[model samples]
Target: MSLDSVAENILNHLWMISWQICILAIVVWGLCKVFSRSSASFRYWLWCIILLRLCLPGDFFQADREGYYIPNSLPTVWETPVTIEDALPENYTGSSSPIVNEPYISLHLSFPGVIVLLWGLCALFLGSIVILRAVYAYAQIKIYPRIEDPAILNLLEECQKSLGIKKHIEVLLSPKESDGPFLTGILFPKIILPQHVIHSWKEEELAPIVLHELAHLKRRDLVVNWLQILLQIVYFFHPVVWYINRKIYTERELICDDLAVFYLGGKRKRYTKTMLRVLQESNDVFSAFGAVGLAEKHHFLKTRIIRILDSKYLGYKKMKKLTLFILTLFAVCSIGVFGQQQTTATKAEGEVVVTYSIFTVQDGKEKSLNPEIFFLSGVDVKKQQKFAPGEYTLLISQAGYHHILKKISIPDGVKKFHIQEQIQPLRREIKKTSKDGVDIDVVIDGDFPAGERIDPEIVALNGKDVRDNVFQPGTYRLKISQPGYATIEEAVTIPKDAKTFVISRTLSTNVRKVITQISYDVQDNKRPQITMEKIGTKEKILINSDTKIKPDSYLLHIYQQHYFPIVSKVHVWPDDRPYVMQFQLVSKPVRIRLDVRYDDKKNLPQQLVTLSDLEGKAVQVVHDNHRIKPGKYMLNIQHPDYTFGREKYIQIHPGDQFLILEKMAKKASSPSGKEYTKLFFK
Candidate 1:
């Protein structure tokens, strides 16, 4: 596949996964709210489920099935194998012929392509932001000095042991006093402390801070933080993702706080006091750098303080049963959301009830499949029967209709099978005879009016002479001939029940007469030579006043020296009346007459008038008349005696005669000068 197609597939998958995540997030949110009294650790795990679902690939739970079986064995009833060609009508010509020229292919972008392009660009932009932010965060943390104080190292080791964390973690001290203690890093985790907190705070007051930061390490929240960041970058356009990310962050902090309070010997007041002190002294710049900091926004801080101070909130035990139930529920729901069965045709072993209906193609009349004539593998079949799972060939033959032979397969699991077939009628030679003479009507180009009759010469039927337009009732190749019309030959069937068989045939004319009339916009004695060319042929025929040509559409090319050539399409039908083609040609040169109606005629000679074409090329004017090519031009008239020069835009068409009249003041006046411009045809 092309890159565009792959990207489009990814975009479609992302859209599907996005909505699925939205539903999962809503469900998890509702569960967390309903279990409000539960431990934050439980709610945190629920959000982790959302994160895990985001990482799942599309089609993770789809089923796979085998291919369907198609019956290929022929029936033994018909010893001679029948093919589709034998079932087709004798007059069937198949489909129409392909076009001579290749079709034009369009390069226009489709709507889905545009959408995919936009999605790719946005994803690339968000990805760039994420990478840059990560890089900047790494650089910011690298500058912090590593803490070497034995007292702080001992305190950290004590906290890690208390939290049952076995991994080795680094410690750093921030130089700025406003920076709070935050937990950063994944593989080599680090906890950065504010400079003032290390120097001013005592061991008792600082224990809660160290414990809170270590609690993040125990919960493996740094890894979850990375997942949240990845999802935020991928689903940047999705509002639900951002909402869920916020909830995860809030729940994550609360869970860590719970761990810190528990490790601090259940002294909620002491832990709460240290959290408030850290929040007061530090800003939230570390969180933007992907660090789990003690500082939070005012609203989130308020909720945290309220939850920590509430005596009953911390007393609630972890509901392990409820957590398990919710986990199982979400697991089932996830399976329902993402699980899809792979479609395949499978074969099975079972008896299939088969029913069939046959009909004539010409008329929608249903036909019966006789048991004696119609058979499946030489076994006589009924209207409906139970068949073992296997391939079988059915042969259906009617008197007038063509025989139908089909191969069908009965799969293992199919309970019922329906077969509907439309049979084409065969072209059988008519053997019936009629008594009275057969009446024949011949129409020349649909020209025969009502009650109007013209006798056309009857040629021959089946190579036998047609006597007085009468014939024995049988199928014959009827041939018709007329003086001005083309010959017509077709098969005709005569019925025995009818006293008189009527035949009607319409014939097209072979040749037509065309009359050409040429008129010019400008009166001239020059006559343009008109040539005619058929639509798809290269031969050009010269057309005179009266021309006789085949009945087809033609392109007429009329051209003369110093005149624009005219090309037009003319359709000549096969009719009695001559086709008349009228064309009007235009001359190449345009005429312009400039009449200067000035108060003083002597100033006209001093008027420097020039006409410039649209390209600013000047056209020479002689005797106040200019003959130039048809186009738009600028007419500028500048006189030393007038107050202002007159400039106007004019358009000249082929064979156009324009007269421009301009009245100018005799003397150069101030603001009250009068000027009149009038344009008309000569």
Candidate 2:
């Protein structure tokens, strides 16, 4: 494959892998509960699991690929074209066939190719730097000053005995500028120390750092560190992987500190002091994953001290091992639970369950068939298992035989729905071929209304235009179709003797024009009710996004309370353009502030301000500053303890703002003389 193709594949892999990483991250986050109160060993294992996931690409972890139907090109089915964005400067009226068969992607390289190339270059640069740093660190180990003090060796031996460690470790003193202490290597472990601290450090002060490095070897962290660095070089683009690597190293230090403190009379203060001194002297390249350094990035120093001083941390004896075992089991199971691809083929409440099945055409006498290479519709999502209620087209085609298509309509109704179909086999016959093999002409015979034309889209077997097609002596399926008409499927049999054959078809028209008008509460200042007026009759339909309507002229209206209503005249006809109705309800808003009152309270009566339309549909406002469309509505104040003594009708106009203060509750026996504020901004 060419580099372009390889890049494209990598781009696709990254796209898939990104989503897999997201699922694994969520599972890992939940597994972190074990690290909270359990041993550091589990957290190290968890980091390993995350790093393992990073090394895997998207294709590595997936459920069995389910067999799904693939659709072919058909005339009965229509779809919006896929065009490159910004390819055209003009507004997309969707009036023309936007299929620019050539690459309209501009420039030679594809967009995905550009992204993949950029990622590859970045990975190459970062991987080279990492490898170079690892080589340099190893070279530094070779030339660094060696610590040959016998007393220091005895102190290391003593600490190792207390921790039950048996591996032989070599000690080398780093340059004065180097970081305090660190451990590196696998078969032969090396403990590197700074020269300045080695000369001035007391045996007790230096022993903790030495033992801390030894703890790593016992925990087999050096091997994990190598794995982390190698995978980091491979997946350099993933920030999550790098972050988890840091967490692993940070927690490694904390765990080793626990081991070293256990050796020194569990003296947390003395161990912390030693770490602080080491932090000040050490200056090594801490980015090397395999090198277990004494000091973390300076920001983590406060946290390290806290963890060392804290009674309960990772490696503490706060929680029982059984709990840790169960948590580890639970974490492993959680990862496994979400690791595999989710198989969710669910039907929502009140949604119809649709099942699509296919059978191949039976050959000769044996009526057996296989379900392969059939196209079904309404399967929008990739690997979608279930079908929802909607209009879909199923197209079937075979070699030498004409294509057969059926428009499948699953209407909203009961729960269970099933559709089964058998493919039709094409018949072949030996015949004489003239200068022109066969001629299939498409004709439309019907009276169409003005501004509408029946341009029959004729398709023949073998995907040839039936309007003027040449074919061998065989049975051919001819599909002659037009928008807003019933499709006719005809089979044309060309005779051997005859030089020409004509397959003439007729088209029929149905009611495909509609006009609509809609109206709702104008005073509420909410969205208007939009509906379509039915064709040949006075009916209405509430049109939502993606609603399929018959090809007809329509008048759509969406009007609120008092302003002028929106009117749209839409005509759906056969064309390369979309039938657009660019119109909206026009209205001006008026702001209204309400002050509710009771028997003796001046305002704030604790009443709901209710506004209702003529249809008695009401919307309640709990606070002030509400904008209402210019219209008439019933205004009333309501409270739990008392009812509105009277109801009022209010009319708001454009560019009007007002405050309405009215009596809120049922009047008391002697409160008839009480005054009220003006109800409108006069």
Candidate 3:
């Protein structure tokens, strides 16, 4: 195979290995979360189970090549003889057949993208849960009272003191009136109590319940619960983790139950019965101290019941041994799987060593950037030397900026080099400003000669620079009193792009604030103008010159300032001077006149409207008690519509013309009516 193909194959292999490591890491994390609180003995058993799966009796840890002595593209100095054990494949094999062991990832399809996509989905799942928790808290606060009942408040205060927790606690009663208790709190912890149980329980019975919940608070079970929730997010795709999560939550409740029973000491039996009763009366929102008898949580309670009643307690000596053994096993496995990769780099000095270094500079000053940002350049940061003598090319690029390229050759003995490059700041200039009383118009251009790509400042004509960001187009006051100018004030309209030109005149004296009208006539030029006037209603509209227009078209769209626009289509061409465009406005219909322009070099229509003699007929809409008065009025709609396969026109107003096409349809359609209708619509 070619070198490119070989390199590609190697990269694919590495990618698969990396993906497997990531999956294994995720499984490890889930296992850690699950068994962290389990008995140390149980964790050792779990580790043994996992190790057995990884190193089944006949599995090969090293690749085998018995007789091959082929040279590799990657530098190799010596060829070592391979024995039968060393000649085994990396995968598991049976006595009669060979099978590839792919426990962490499937090998059927080489879909490297799936690894990143799955990881992204995992992150998104965790992120969504976090966001949902915040939203749920907000929604709860919006609906529930900030303060709890005085009776519950006093209980919490006493419990808080007993628990030695520094944070204040709030209690809320569930107004939903449901059975079963649910403890939910984190920052600014709150206990939601069901009204039913609190009313039913006597003062003496409440003490044990309060003690149980206070135990949860003392141990910071709420935070642990959040951690558990986060772990579930990481293992969202694993069904086993989900099952284990449900089990762990149940176990947490049981652990809390046991602690509560111990706190009661001599009255453990009575408290357990009361706990069961509390679970029964859990209709009230379960405060942290209370248990709601939710059917779903009953299975967990049953397990807790069994564990508390059972008399199987290990002595300290055995417990200590179990703990030490589990911890040691975990440390060894973690170091072996993950840490070994680091130590494997320390081989004899025949291998080529690659190093990478990033040089960052901001405003001519060196700045520290995160090493992760350098990963865009292909480099294994952990395995490769960070800074070493070598020939290397560096490229730096950020959003909305040109890329920088630099090449440097380091001598054999040199360890590191720091390079610097100055990046120019963007310059923004205010081209023009026009103000008409309350409203102001400012023009800005992003393009400047400076190396930067953003505008710095655009001062208003009369007003101070409102803000740095771009402003909406309109009219504005022009006032400028610089040191050299007497008084610079001009009305300016900011154009979209090109030159940053303003038309402000200087005044005699320099002053801070002065109101003056400024015209943004940066350059003098004559151009065709289109205007519309409503006949009797008296509404005048101006058409923008920079609009995208189609040629040989009769349709022109006119927009009113701060109002819905009007669409005009040409209905008829009368042999007259006005050359009016008639259109109907769907809402508050307004009549407008347009000066149609054709190519000056081409043959002009026999009777066409010109810019020199452009007169518009005014449109009028008489409104009487929400009903429009019917009247004979002149309207202008531009552009003809091509509806059928060929061009067609719809009437714009009451007195428009129509075309008769009797045989045209007959020629285009088949004998059947269905085909004729299909052709009509199509």
Candidate 4:
């Protein structure tokens, strides 16, 4: 094939594969939305799958097979060679035919050829721009000087140690003060920091900055950045690809932020403030060099800051192995479905001409086929058509007729074949009957007392008892009633078409007088406030004595000063007598004092004490008294000078309790010279 033909073929293949790539991209995008709350690294990795799929061929896992030829509305014409004697008529006296002596050639480019040329030129143009930008950024990097400050070097070393990174990384100071910190280079990874930041920022403030850049190295984001650039160069025309690229970059920064927060002992406020300051004072200039930065885009600053403060990001939970496996499996399956090549049909010389006809079987007789009938394959087989000798599925369908599908095979030696199928007409039976009474069943919807039997006579139709459970086909008033429930009154119509009718209703509770009494033990003789609330609703009514309220299942609540609130379920039945409920409220315990002391018996002041549930959720400390609900809790103590191990699991119960925690002696350094503190509580 000529070069143009070859290029056209490749372009056609790419165009086909581009749609498949788009499908995979959409699938990955949807999965990312589904797992939006998952780890940012997981989402980033999910986007990487699309990039990998884009590099695959269209028929990567497709199997070679024979194509099946099916006829369409267009008829195939065959031409035969004719001799000179056969071409001339018997009455013709023509001697010769006219001919031209001059010769000319016509050069024409096909539509596909033009498209291929355009695509090539556009790709070349964009690819050149990308290369030039990368070159310029790299050249700019060569002019920047590497930092040699001892304090900054020590801080970098400490950050590296904290992140457990063993790779040799270089630190460069940007020539301009507006440039932010970013990690560049794949082989020799270098971290570029703004000159002003290095001179003005404190070591404590710079720790998170260095840690964020080092995280990119630890996660090998630079390599992924190169892949992203390559995808952009290839699929530059695809808008979805650009959107996905933006999402990948956003998630990448979020992942780095998570890593930075984790290594900083989960101090998000300080790190977030530093990140905001850095982004505010810096500009995005290193991304063109294919580098990953802390804040690459100003618009993403809000998202980054919000995500930094989010508890989910702060927790930094890794994606589960099962979830990862499922996602990978789904992507692979999608590739298999979308990447498979479509079979091409080719006509053979030794094919058979087939004619098809349909007839309907009505009233036990064959009749002419309906004009509305057609084949499911969308082939109008009114004329004869050539087909390869193979098995084919014939789908004949029409309105008001049962669809028929028949399989037929044409023998190789056959020159012609006829396929005739009979379809059965659909018949529906309709019955006409005299109008009659319908059975009316009344159903009561409510929480009834267990083992309580309800009589059907409670329901009355048209102000009369419906003892027979049948009503004539006419409109009538329905009155449904039950004890402790408001009576329901409505007009209902019984239709002659339906054989039975059901009336279901939920009756509201009836209003009644309620009296509640509560007693509690306290230092002062004070009456607690009493309130009554209906179950499954937000309506609350204060009750003391002879308070008119709905009669149903309600919650009785009593609250007093220095006492635990009491809640009890009370059921009031319908009666003329006053409903009375009594309850005894328990008094709350005194405040629990937490005493933390060193081995020398000195109180540990300025220490942060927190009580959390077993699930790590902070428990509310009421009135600075540490009065919490009785349950098992984990106690955590934080101090700048002291090191606390894992949280202590403590069980709290009702009543007065005292906790005394004493610090043990510092253990000898295990060669690393790291001191450890152990606390025991009783």
Candidate 5:
């Protein structure tokens, strides 16, 4: 990629990257709130993700792109997709199936250079503000006298000893009625104390004041502050980032307060009083610049005081180790969240979220329907949330009607979309309901969706199946005694005006089903299931088994994980036929040896080759070694001299013995390692 191309890529994705930073900042804020009462260490650690978001260029943990379809997209400059096209050689045309970029959306457009020029100006403007503040704060510090009292020196030694601070911090007296106290310096740190206050105070009150500054150093808030100060300039336009920066400082003070209290025991009353005193007389100390201070504005100071007295913060005292453990976990997550290339499009530009709330309209009003109340997992809009701006599917179920699945779109430009859905009239019979208007008949029927009836022997109502039929005008608790399926207790209410009460019970064999969707790398086979032998090809079962089978004593086994095989306990229905569950095979991981020929006499070029499978796991390509699963693969082969690869299309079949890839040896005047690559999309 040239310099112009690099600049163009960044400019093209400038809005998206900024949008992602804002979103991540909001996430950091929400996570901090959840762990608010827990510990400040974890809360401060959460901001590290935001830091990583700004520092790292790409996404870390990739969302699932298996079924997520990206239309007419191109990969970014940072992503080198080892697509099937890249694996094949030039002048080779075996499979004409289209191959695209991995999970990245790119558009080749003539972007005006003025956007970046204006960006530089805005960044410079913010950067100048931060610099001016630092200069102004440092200038204000110069007006104060350096303190050297023996008593104050002895108190400072005590704070350093207790806080495990080895670096010598210069303590200076602030001007009377000036900045109360603050530790400031981009390169070095100094704690400026109030002149009139410290001299009149004893060790007890003075210890918490100075220890608060030491806590800033111990927690490394200075480094975090400096980083935020710089990044604010980079993302000055995004207000979410400014909010996050404010949150960092607010939480930073609370953390220091807690640390001071933890280290200086039996001083909560004194510590709280000292913090209050500092806030009342607090000047433009740390508040005006990149420094840690005792207190800030009244609004933030009040929140800190309330949080300081919060006894719940002490509950996490014994769990400091757990906080450290969570910090470690967060650090580990940062590796995946920051280091990996993002292979999927998230909430991008012109995308909006659409949320749905379904209601049943009866005689005159709208009655809100809650899926949880009926133990149904219909469109869980409450928890599942509104999907991104795209076509979405929703399943709504009511007692009378068949489950309705409606496809809707979250149109662009709109932020929050409330889709009003009204329930339709019943088309299918409510088989799970009553039989007659007189007596209540308890019948075990098939599952709700499949409608396959299975007779469960042990059926009881309130532990008494003997008297479930024809009950009085009241509600009865009916239960089905089954093992695999959940214990279902459905209530049947017999109205005063009704004659017979019929209650139908739905029994499901499997609670969860894993559907393995298969995609042919070469072409669409239109087959639902594939055997291991006939993995990735046109060969399929090609038959729809329409014959109905009875849900008997045999267990319906299904697998969830790729390698995990599920087995169930033996049943007692006396049905003795083995049933096989099949999955559509997308790609097969087969062992193959690649024969790369340059010349009959010359040995193959010594280079490293690797391939990424459908699941995006990378495996090195060694001759006659390593088996890979079936899927679309990206291949990379490195050579010392001339370019030998292109955006070629090659399909590896299950029954194929081996593949012979040919490369012509061309002399190069200059070794442009990747100049021979194919066009992104054709």
Candidate 6:
């Protein structure tokens, strides 16, 4: 692709966020279907066409062309090179700056993005299928049983008028009816009044039943119902959002019912009675495909009926302009919570502010040497409350090395800068040695000199000239080659304490055949051994072990790589068999001595407490509840609400008891208590 095309493609990809698009698609399909007529199916089709058009490969397709709809909204990611000193808080007492200059790239396309795409596609597909099925079913019903009752038809007309909603309501009678009344027009708005139901209902009973269903229809509750289905399709991955949506749907139904009751006035009592009778008799008419007979719909109807029957009715009062303004302000403030921005300081030099940091390179690994790595602009660069010229200093250094000081002069107009200091080589002379019968002296060189660059081919030992050293008993290799000079090859061996000389034989152009041999003393190998001791009863046990390992520090695994790590400190002894000594752990201990110390000079209380089990139930004291004896004893501790604490454990005798402190952060709180309860006890 051309660079421009590639750039455009990248920009477009960056602009697209599947989750936001899915939300837009849902909003469009829902609001349009709710407001428009089924006869205007083309309009619904048009909405889909517009969405597909945006996703298609095209030119000059601005993201904002559709206004708020389909505009991929995203959070911002900060990207700036900053010095280490900039990252530190103003009151930081540490010698190094805390500023981190590394740019932060927010990954917009996360798991939710993929999930949202799947959700939107599923919603669109299912919604289309449902719409087609409902419309086709409505068409077939229109040919079967048309609205015949003039009074019922007039009531429907009056209901629509009274509700101030203008829409065509297809009233149909089905021979396939088993029992009861139902309202079925969610996608293809229709009232499927069963022939059996109409025959059984009296004139007075019919009006309320029809009105209850009409109330749903007039409010476009069908559209909302369909939208709910669409949202479920997208957010099926999150069960919580589904639960929230379900509650919202139930609340929505209740609100509609309240409106219907208010409009009917005194007729609400009769309406409610008719609702209960219909619910009881027409239980078989509950169609899963319809809008009015959902599981929560019936439950909501009962609640509404009970609420209206038991309570003194109060009409909803319309808010005045002043009240509306105040309410709007509160709403805006609520939404503002989601619009919060993270403020970071930056160095401003003239119109352009610059913030930068320094990085160090060693053995091909780049490490940021600057301690303070963050810089902010216009805020508190120095926390002086007054704007200062954005200028910063950074120093980079490593152990056993000289420091590289950088004067970060922010150019008058530069906004950001990145400073890098190439590390200079700290060459050490490898002296010749002769011991146990070998002798050799070799000089190894090649650390990138100041202002000098080393070719990666030589560094990687790929091709080109390489520095050579005589074969030695050490853990290093070398190559020797100089520009415009014949290559020389020599072998040298160094002994423990004896001095030896390595005489380099310069290579003539025609010379070949050089022998190289490396010799070094090998120490005896020893395998690391582990021993675990069980200190408590069968149910409770304390485990401890020791090992004399060749490596000073190694990974100590309990179970395997799966669980968290417990780093063990290895202690070596002069008379011992180079083995680990001991560690302490409490299995299921009745009482554990908490070894608490204040400091190097002060001693603190060492309290003894009984252990709890995984279920937060105190371990049963079979023998003694007061004190556990010195021998190995099994104790069970169960704490249901405090699982993460050291409530449950096993005890080991003849060894120091160490209670495992469970982190409270890992505990889950019950929903019945405070909205969010503490996961951990003291």
Alpha-carbon lDDT, every model: 0.64, 0.58, 0.39, 0.64, 0.54, 0.41
Error (Å) of candidate 5 at residue 619 is 69
The sequence of per-residue lDDT tens digits that candidate 6 reaches over residues 159-195 is 7787776777767776665523456655556776767
- 584-663 per-residue lDDT for model 3 (tens digits): 22223223222333223221122111111112344322111112222332332211111113323222221122222111
* TM-score result, candidate 1: 0.43
Top candidate when judged by TM-score against the true structure: 4
Candidate RMSDs in order: 25.4, 26.3, 30.8, 26.7, 27.2, 26.8
Which candidate, 4 or 5, would have the higher TM-score against the true structure? 4
TM-score (all chains, Cα) for each model: 0.43, 0.42, 0.38, 0.44, 0.41, 0.34
Q: Compared with the true structure, what per-residue lDDT tens digits does model 2 show for residues 29-148?
A: 667773466576566566666666666554311222221222323322222211222222245332111111111111346777888778878878878887888788787776654456
lDDT of 6: 0.41
Cα-based RMSD of candidate 5:
27.2
Which tens-of-lDDT digit does each residue in 1-682 have in candidate 5?
1123334445645565676666666666677677665666567667766766677664211222111212212222112212223323355443221111122222333344456667778899878888887898778775554566778878888889998888766777776565667787645668887766775766777888788888888777788889888888887777877877877777678778888887788467778888777766655334437787887676776677777676655612444676678767766674455334244243234434444455655777667765321101233455545455555433444554333332334444334555544454443232333544354444344432222234565666556652333345667676776644556777756678665455555565543222234444334444443222121223322222432232333333322232323334322221223233433333435666665545332334353455656454655444443455544566655555434565343455554344536463544564443542222100
TM-score quality measure for candidate 5: 0.41
- Stretches of candidate 5 exceeding 4 Å from the true structure: 1-7, 58-112, 282-288, 315-682
Prediction 3 TM-score vs. true? 0.38
Please list the residue runs of candidate 1 whose C-alpha ends up more than 4 Å from where it truly belongs after superposition. Answer: 1-8, 60-109, 283-285, 315-322, 341-682
Model 1 lowest lDDT segment of ten:
95-104
**Root-mean-square deviation of candidate 6:** 26.8
Q: Residue 488 deviation, candidate 1, in Å?
A: 65
Superior by TM-score: candidate 1 or candidate 2: 1
Clashes of 3: 53
Q: How well does candidate 6 score on lDDT at residue 148?
A: 55
